[model samples]
Target: MSSATQRRVFLVAALLVAAVALGVISMGGIGENLVYFWTPAQVHENASKAVGATIRMGGVVQADSVDWQPDTQALTFTVGESAVDTATPITVHAQSAPPQMFREGIGVVVEGTMTDAGTFRADKVMVKHSNEYRAPTDGMAPADLYATVEEL
Candidate 1:
Protein backbone atom coordinates (compact mmCIF):
# COMPACT_ATOMS: atom_id res chain seq x y z
CA MET A 1 0.00 0.00 0.00
CA SER A 2 1.07 3.58 -0.58
CA SER A 3 2.55 5.41 2.44
CA ALA A 4 -0.20 8.03 2.25
CA THR A 5 -2.92 5.33 2.19
CA GLN A 6 -1.28 3.50 5.12
CA ARG A 7 -1.18 6.69 7.19
CA ARG A 8 -4.86 7.38 6.47
CA VAL A 9 -5.80 3.81 7.55
CA PHE A 10 -3.81 4.21 10.78
CA LEU A 11 -5.54 7.50 11.56
CA VAL A 12 -8.99 5.99 10.98
CA ALA A 13 -8.18 3.04 13.24
CA ALA A 14 -6.99 5.33 16.02
CA LEU A 15 -10.18 7.39 15.76
CA LEU A 16 -12.31 4.28 16.05
CA VAL A 17 -10.38 3.08 19.09
CA ALA A 18 -10.65 6.51 20.76
CA ALA A 19 -14.39 6.60 20.14
CA VAL A 20 -14.88 3.16 21.69
CA ALA A 21 -12.72 4.12 24.67
CA LEU A 22 -14.69 7.31 25.24
CA GLY A 23 -18.01 5.49 25.05
CA VAL A 24 -16.88 2.83 27.54
CA ILE A 25 -15.49 5.42 29.99
CA SER A 26 -18.70 7.47 29.86
CA MET A 27 -20.86 4.40 30.42
CA GLY A 28 -18.84 3.30 33.44
CA GLY A 29 -19.23 6.70 35.08
CA ILE A 30 -22.97 6.75 34.44
CA GLY A 31 -23.48 3.21 35.71
CA GLU A 32 -21.62 3.87 38.91
CA ASN A 33 -23.73 6.91 39.69
CA LEU A 34 -27.04 5.24 38.91
CA VAL A 35 -29.10 4.10 41.90
CA TYR A 36 -32.05 1.92 41.05
CA PHE A 37 -35.51 2.72 42.39
CA TRP A 38 -37.94 -0.10 43.08
CA THR A 39 -41.01 -0.90 45.11
CA PRO A 40 -41.22 -3.35 47.99
CA ALA A 41 -42.68 -5.98 45.73
CA GLN A 42 -40.07 -5.37 43.09
CA VAL A 43 -37.33 -5.69 45.66
CA HIS A 44 -38.67 -9.07 46.67
CA GLU A 45 -39.06 -10.15 43.10
CA ASN A 46 -35.53 -9.07 42.31
CA ALA A 47 -34.04 -10.26 45.55
CA SER A 48 -30.99 -11.78 43.96
CA LYS A 49 -30.32 -8.70 41.89
CA ALA A 50 -31.16 -6.21 44.66
CA VAL A 51 -28.84 -7.57 47.33
CA GLY A 52 -25.80 -5.48 48.36
CA ALA A 53 -26.44 -2.67 45.89
CA THR A 54 -27.55 0.86 46.64
CA ILE A 55 -31.27 0.75 45.98
CA ARG A 56 -34.09 3.18 46.60
CA MET A 57 -37.29 1.42 47.59
CA GLY A 58 -40.43 3.39 47.16
CA GLY A 59 -43.42 2.26 49.19
CA VAL A 60 -45.90 3.22 51.87
CA VAL A 61 -44.96 2.96 55.54
CA GLN A 62 -47.16 0.35 57.20
CA ALA A 63 -49.02 1.83 60.13
CA ASP A 64 -48.70 -1.08 62.52
CA SER A 65 -45.13 -1.83 61.62
CA VAL A 66 -43.60 1.51 62.56
CA ASP A 67 -41.31 1.43 65.57
CA TRP A 68 -39.27 4.52 66.32
CA GLN A 69 -36.90 4.45 69.27
CA PRO A 70 -35.75 7.97 69.95
CA ASP A 71 -33.37 6.79 72.62
CA THR A 72 -31.44 4.63 70.18
CA GLN A 73 -32.12 6.83 67.17
CA ALA A 74 -33.21 3.78 65.28
CA LEU A 75 -36.37 3.61 63.19
CA THR A 76 -37.74 0.38 61.89
CA PHE A 77 -40.77 0.08 59.69
CA THR A 78 -42.35 -2.19 57.15
CA VAL A 79 -43.08 -0.74 53.75
CA GLY A 80 -45.82 -2.11 51.57
CA GLU A 81 -46.44 -1.53 47.92
CA SER A 82 -49.32 0.68 48.91
CA ALA A 83 -51.62 1.36 51.83
CA VAL A 84 -54.06 -1.35 50.73
CA ASP A 85 -51.44 -3.71 49.37
CA THR A 86 -51.48 -6.87 51.50
CA ALA A 87 -49.46 -9.11 49.25
CA THR A 88 -45.99 -7.73 49.83
CA PRO A 89 -44.25 -5.73 52.54
CA ILE A 90 -40.55 -5.24 53.24
CA THR A 91 -39.00 -4.33 56.55
CA VAL A 92 -36.62 -1.37 56.55
CA HIS A 93 -34.26 -0.32 59.34
CA ALA A 94 -32.88 3.20 59.44
CA GLN A 95 -30.28 4.27 61.95
CA SER A 96 -31.20 7.92 61.48
CA ALA A 97 -34.25 9.65 62.77
CA PRO A 98 -37.35 9.62 60.67
CA PRO A 99 -38.42 12.72 58.76
CA GLN A 100 -41.05 15.00 60.24
CA MET A 101 -43.62 13.81 57.72
CA PHE A 102 -42.65 10.15 57.92
CA ARG A 103 -45.64 8.29 59.26
CA GLU A 104 -47.90 5.35 58.71
CA GLY A 105 -49.53 5.12 55.29
CA ILE A 106 -47.22 7.81 53.96
CA GLY A 107 -45.24 7.30 50.77
CA VAL A 108 -41.52 6.99 51.36
CA VAL A 109 -38.39 6.33 49.37
CA VAL A 110 -35.72 4.59 51.40
CA GLU A 111 -32.22 4.48 49.95
CA GLY A 112 -30.19 1.50 51.06
CA THR A 113 -29.36 -2.08 50.31
CA MET A 114 -30.94 -5.45 50.96
CA THR A 115 -29.27 -7.65 53.51
CA ASP A 116 -29.01 -11.44 53.71
CA ALA A 117 -31.54 -11.29 56.51
CA GLY A 118 -34.13 -10.20 53.92
CA THR A 119 -34.48 -6.72 55.39
CA PHE A 120 -33.53 -3.41 53.86
CA ARG A 121 -30.94 -1.26 55.65
CA ALA A 122 -31.64 2.34 54.81
CA ASP A 123 -29.04 5.08 55.05
CA LYS A 124 -31.43 7.80 53.88
CA VAL A 125 -35.18 8.06 54.16
CA MET A 126 -37.09 10.43 51.92
CA VAL A 127 -40.76 11.13 52.43
CA LYS A 128 -42.76 11.65 49.29
CA HIS A 129 -45.37 14.42 49.45
CA SER A 130 -47.64 16.22 47.09
CA ASN A 131 -46.08 18.93 44.95
CA GLU A 132 -49.33 20.77 44.50
CA TYR A 133 -50.19 23.21 47.26
CA ARG A 134 -53.74 23.16 48.57
CA ALA A 135 -55.07 25.89 50.78
CA PRO A 136 -56.44 24.96 54.18
CA THR A 137 -60.19 24.51 54.17
CA ASP A 138 -60.63 25.24 57.89
CA GLY A 139 -62.26 28.68 57.45
CA MET A 140 -59.26 29.86 55.39
CA ALA A 141 -60.04 31.61 52.14
CA PRO A 142 -57.88 31.56 48.98
CA ALA A 143 -56.39 34.91 49.94
CA ASP A 144 -55.44 33.57 53.34
CA LEU A 145 -53.14 31.04 51.76
CA TYR A 146 -50.91 33.79 50.36
CA ALA A 147 -49.00 36.36 52.42
CA THR A 148 -49.87 40.04 52.15
CA VAL A 149 -48.33 43.20 53.67
CA GLU A 150 -51.50 43.80 55.67
CA GLU A 151 -51.39 40.32 57.18
CA LEU A 152 -47.69 40.65 57.92
Candidate 2:
Protein backbone atom coordinates (compact mmCIF):
# COMPACT_ATOMS: atom_id res chain seq x y z
CA MET A 1 0.00 0.00 0.00
CA SER A 2 1.03 3.62 -0.46
CA SER A 3 2.65 5.23 2.64
CA ALA A 4 -0.10 7.86 2.72
CA THR A 5 -2.84 5.18 2.69
CA GLN A 6 -1.05 3.13 5.37
CA ARG A 7 -0.80 6.18 7.66
CA ARG A 8 -4.51 6.92 7.21
CA VAL A 9 -5.41 3.31 8.06
CA PHE A 10 -3.31 3.35 11.25
CA LEU A 11 -4.90 6.60 12.39
CA VAL A 12 -8.41 5.23 11.79
CA ALA A 13 -7.64 2.03 13.75
CA ALA A 14 -6.24 4.00 16.68
CA LEU A 15 -9.32 6.20 16.77
CA LEU A 16 -11.63 3.19 16.70
CA VAL A 17 -9.75 1.52 19.59
CA ALA A 18 -9.91 4.68 21.66
CA ALA A 19 -13.64 4.98 21.03
CA VAL A 20 -14.25 1.43 22.15
CA ALA A 21 -12.21 1.89 25.31
CA LEU A 22 -14.08 5.06 26.14
CA GLY A 23 -17.39 3.32 25.58
CA VAL A 24 -16.50 0.47 27.94
CA ILE A 25 -15.38 2.80 30.69
CA SER A 26 -18.53 4.86 30.39
CA MET A 27 -20.71 1.73 30.41
CA GLY A 28 -19.16 0.54 33.66
CA GLY A 29 -20.07 3.76 35.44
CA ILE A 30 -23.48 4.06 33.80
CA GLY A 31 -25.10 1.53 36.13
CA GLU A 32 -23.86 3.30 39.23
CA ASN A 33 -24.93 6.70 37.90
CA LEU A 34 -28.31 5.59 36.61
CA VAL A 35 -31.29 5.71 38.95
CA TYR A 36 -33.69 3.08 37.75
CA PHE A 37 -37.24 3.86 38.80
CA TRP A 38 -40.31 1.72 38.34
CA THR A 39 -43.79 1.33 39.69
CA PRO A 40 -44.87 -1.66 41.80
CA ALA A 41 -46.02 -3.56 38.78
CA GLN A 42 -42.85 -2.82 36.89
CA VAL A 43 -40.70 -3.95 39.79
CA HIS A 44 -42.52 -7.24 39.98
CA GLU A 45 -42.27 -7.74 36.26
CA ASN A 46 -38.54 -7.11 36.34
CA ALA A 47 -37.77 -8.53 39.74
CA SER A 48 -34.94 -10.74 38.60
CA LYS A 49 -33.29 -7.94 36.70
CA ALA A 50 -33.53 -5.59 39.68
CA VAL A 51 -32.11 -8.03 42.17
CA GLY A 52 -29.07 -6.55 43.95
CA ALA A 53 -29.27 -3.51 41.68
CA THR A 54 -29.38 0.02 43.04
CA ILE A 55 -32.50 1.80 41.83
CA ARG A 56 -35.28 4.22 42.66
CA MET A 57 -38.71 2.72 43.20
CA GLY A 58 -41.52 5.22 42.67
CA GLY A 59 -45.03 4.69 43.99
CA VAL A 60 -47.82 6.00 46.15
CA VAL A 61 -47.67 5.36 49.86
CA GLN A 62 -50.24 2.91 51.07
CA ALA A 63 -52.56 4.39 53.67
CA ASP A 64 -52.19 3.18 57.25
CA SER A 65 -49.25 1.06 56.28
CA VAL A 66 -46.55 2.82 58.27
CA ASP A 67 -45.36 1.14 61.43
CA TRP A 68 -42.57 3.08 63.12
CA GLN A 69 -40.61 1.97 66.14
CA PRO A 70 -39.85 5.07 68.15
CA ASP A 71 -36.79 3.79 69.97
CA THR A 72 -34.94 2.39 66.98
CA GLN A 73 -36.47 4.79 64.46
CA ALA A 74 -36.97 1.78 62.24
CA LEU A 75 -39.95 1.94 59.91
CA THR A 76 -41.87 -0.58 57.86
CA PHE A 77 -44.42 0.34 55.22
CA THR A 78 -45.75 -0.42 51.81
CA VAL A 79 -44.55 1.75 48.91
CA GLY A 80 -46.49 1.32 45.72
CA GLU A 81 -49.90 1.39 44.10
CA SER A 82 -52.51 -0.45 46.13
CA ALA A 83 -53.70 -2.42 43.13
CA VAL A 84 -50.29 -4.03 42.65
CA ASP A 85 -50.49 -7.66 41.65
CA THR A 86 -47.43 -8.99 43.42
CA ALA A 87 -47.84 -9.55 47.13
CA THR A 88 -44.16 -8.76 47.53
CA PRO A 89 -43.87 -5.08 48.50
CA ILE A 90 -40.78 -2.98 49.08
CA THR A 91 -39.77 -2.79 52.74
CA VAL A 92 -37.55 0.24 53.32
CA HIS A 93 -35.08 0.24 56.21
CA ALA A 94 -33.31 3.46 57.03
CA GLN A 95 -30.82 3.99 59.79
CA SER A 96 -32.00 7.59 60.31
CA ALA A 97 -35.34 9.33 60.26
CA PRO A 98 -37.41 9.55 57.13
CA PRO A 99 -38.21 12.81 55.35
CA GLN A 100 -41.16 14.97 56.45
CA MET A 101 -42.99 14.37 53.19
CA PHE A 102 -42.67 10.64 53.72
CA ARG A 103 -46.20 9.74 54.64
CA GLU A 104 -49.05 7.50 53.67
CA GLY A 105 -50.54 7.94 50.17
CA ILE A 106 -47.87 10.43 49.15
CA GLY A 107 -45.63 9.72 46.20
CA VAL A 108 -42.06 8.75 47.06
CA VAL A 109 -38.84 7.65 45.43
CA VAL A 110 -36.59 5.47 47.55
CA GLU A 111 -32.95 5.27 46.51
CA GLY A 112 -31.21 2.11 47.56
CA THR A 113 -29.92 -1.29 46.70
CA MET A 114 -32.25 -4.25 46.82
CA THR A 115 -31.26 -7.32 48.74
CA ASP A 116 -31.95 -10.98 47.96
CA ALA A 117 -34.24 -10.89 50.98
CA GLY A 118 -36.34 -8.30 49.10
CA THR A 119 -35.63 -5.55 51.61
CA PHE A 120 -34.42 -2.19 50.34
CA ARG A 121 -31.80 -0.38 52.43
CA ALA A 122 -32.34 3.23 51.47
CA ASP A 123 -29.68 5.84 52.01
CA LYS A 124 -31.89 8.59 50.59
CA VAL A 125 -35.59 9.17 50.20
CA MET A 126 -37.05 11.77 47.85
CA VAL A 127 -40.65 12.91 48.03
CA LYS A 128 -42.39 12.92 44.70
CA HIS A 129 -45.80 14.26 43.72
CA SER A 130 -48.91 12.49 44.98
CA ASN A 131 -50.52 12.92 41.56
CA GLU A 132 -53.47 14.42 43.38
CA TYR A 133 -54.24 17.65 41.63
CA ARG A 134 -57.69 19.08 42.25
CA ALA A 135 -59.32 22.30 41.26
CA PRO A 136 -61.23 24.48 43.74
CA THR A 137 -64.62 22.93 44.41
CA ASP A 138 -66.04 25.60 46.74
CA GLY A 139 -68.10 27.14 43.92
CA MET A 140 -65.39 29.67 43.16
CA ALA A 141 -66.09 31.87 40.15
CA PRO A 142 -64.50 30.71 36.89
CA ALA A 143 -62.22 33.72 37.01
CA ASP A 144 -60.52 32.55 40.24
CA LEU A 145 -58.57 29.50 38.99
CA TYR A 146 -56.80 31.43 36.24
CA ALA A 147 -56.69 34.80 37.99
CA THR A 148 -53.14 34.40 39.26
CA VAL A 149 -51.78 32.75 36.12
CA GLU A 150 -53.48 35.26 33.86
CA GLU A 151 -52.07 38.17 35.80
CA LEU A 152 -48.57 36.72 35.53
lDDT for each residue of candidate 1 in 19-101, tens digit (9 for 90 to 100): 99999877767655564578888898889988899889999988789999999999999999988678889899999978867
Error of 1 at 112 (Å): 0.5
lDDT of 2 by residue, 10-116 (tens): 99999999999889778777754564687666777777877787777877767777777879988766786562424656777766566655677777788776778
The best candidate by TM-score is 1
Flag regions of model 2 displaced more than 4 Å: 1-36, 82-88, 130-152
Consecutive 10-residue window with the lowest summed lDDT within model 1? 143-152
Instruction: Compute the lDDT for candidate 1.
Output: 0.87
TM-score to native of every candidate shown: 0.65, 0.55
Candidate 2 displacement at residue 126 in angstroms: 1.2
